[model samples]
Target: MSVTRITDVSEPLVAAFANLVPQLSSSATPPTRDEIADFLAQDGVYLFTYSNDDGAILGMLTLATFVIPTGKRAWIEDVVVDEAARGHGAGAALVEAACEYAHEIGAKTIDLTSRPSREAANRLYRRCGFVARETNVYRYGG
Candidate 1:
């Protein structure tokens, strides 16, 4: 029912990630408890979870923030809502939370990338105030 940043790792969070990772990326494996703990411990890396009133986690997202010569920057990554919970506004809530955090952290801009084939998600991002940009996003390797 609400979005909150995760500061500690727990079995419920571990299990939720196990269920959500594949939904985010078929080729990516879910992180273990220790891995999640390590990630949470990293500076400027944040993990937020959206859970129902009964404490059932329904969606999650990562917000990474950093400072450089230009200014503060944030990236919203790996946003995914549970398949059954898609239409109930969890994705929008998660995104709004991240954007608020980005503003709090003084980030001038927040960025995210979605595959063109994910039409619904792309539309959601646009509706959430992200503008499409013409730029090449190059990965270091395949």
Candidate 2:
């Protein structure tokens, strides 16, 4: 599969949704088709697609930026590869692309969180040079 940044404004984001939804938390709300298109129209969010030679989108990743007093940071919010495409390097390619993009944007660090239940994903992150930080991530969201 080939890795590409999603840059075509006229392209349909729906093409990548099915591969993404299942990878999200079960209780999380899936974006409506319209929301996907609107999100793609914004800046500071990077979406990458892994497509086969036939142009079927097999995986996607969403990276968002945070600007705080410290500096800019990048967080990997979603990463999903079609079940049938797992053994291949689509996931890795997506992560690698994010790293390149993060560097391009002068981000101080790239962070991501995976559920404890997702052992394979944790392993992949570690293998990709991510250290298990000691800091705890807290949320006060409703």
Candidate 3:
């Protein structure tokens, strides 16, 4: 598998994203083409896809890096691997690529959150060198 940054919002990309969002969350809606384009145009956001040799997308993740008062922070979000492609290392490849890219861009730290019910995903994150944080994660909106 190879991890590639998505620089454009094409039909295939949008379709794949639509298919993956429901897998990531039951209530979350897939982003529209304009939304994807807007996100791609953002200053410090990157969308990446993990694909097989045949050029089929197997997994995807987004990395958002920004400079806050403290320093630069990188956050990985919306990670999802196609259920059919789960055992072939697509998830790992995506995470590795995101982490490498974040580090290359001078991020002070990388952060991500996984639901406890996703046992396999939690294990994958741990294997990728992420430790469980003791801090509370509060969200203000959906």
Backbone clashes under 3 angstroms, per model: 2, 0, 0
Candidate 1: where is the Cα deviation over 4 Å?
A: none
Model 2: per-residue lDDT, tens digit, 18-106? 44676655666667766777887787898888888888888889899878999999999788888888868888888989988998989
lDDT leader:
1
Off by over 4 Å in 3: none
- Give the clashing pairs for model 1: 1-51, 1-52
> Model 3, range 1-142, lDDT digits (tens) per residue?
6899999988878988898999888998999999989989999999999888888787899999999999999999999999999977888899999999999999999999998999999999999999999999899986
- List runs of model 2 lying over 4 Å from the truth: 9-12
Q: After superposition, how far is residue 7 of candidate 2 from its true place, in Å?
A: 2.8
lDDT tens digits, residue span 1-142, model 1? 9999999998999999999999999999999889999999999999999999999999999999999999999999999999999988999999999999999989999999999999989989998999999999999977
Give TM-scores for every candidate, taking all chains together and pairing residue i with residue i: 0.97, 0.88, 0.95
How big is the positional error of residue 116 in model 1, measured in Å on the Cα after superposition? 0.8
lDDT of each: 0.95, 0.81, 0.92
Of 1 and 2, the candidate ranking higher by lDDT: 1
TM-score-based ranking, best first?
1, 3, 2
lDDT of 3 at 72: 92
Candidate 2: lDDT over CA atoms? Answer: 0.81
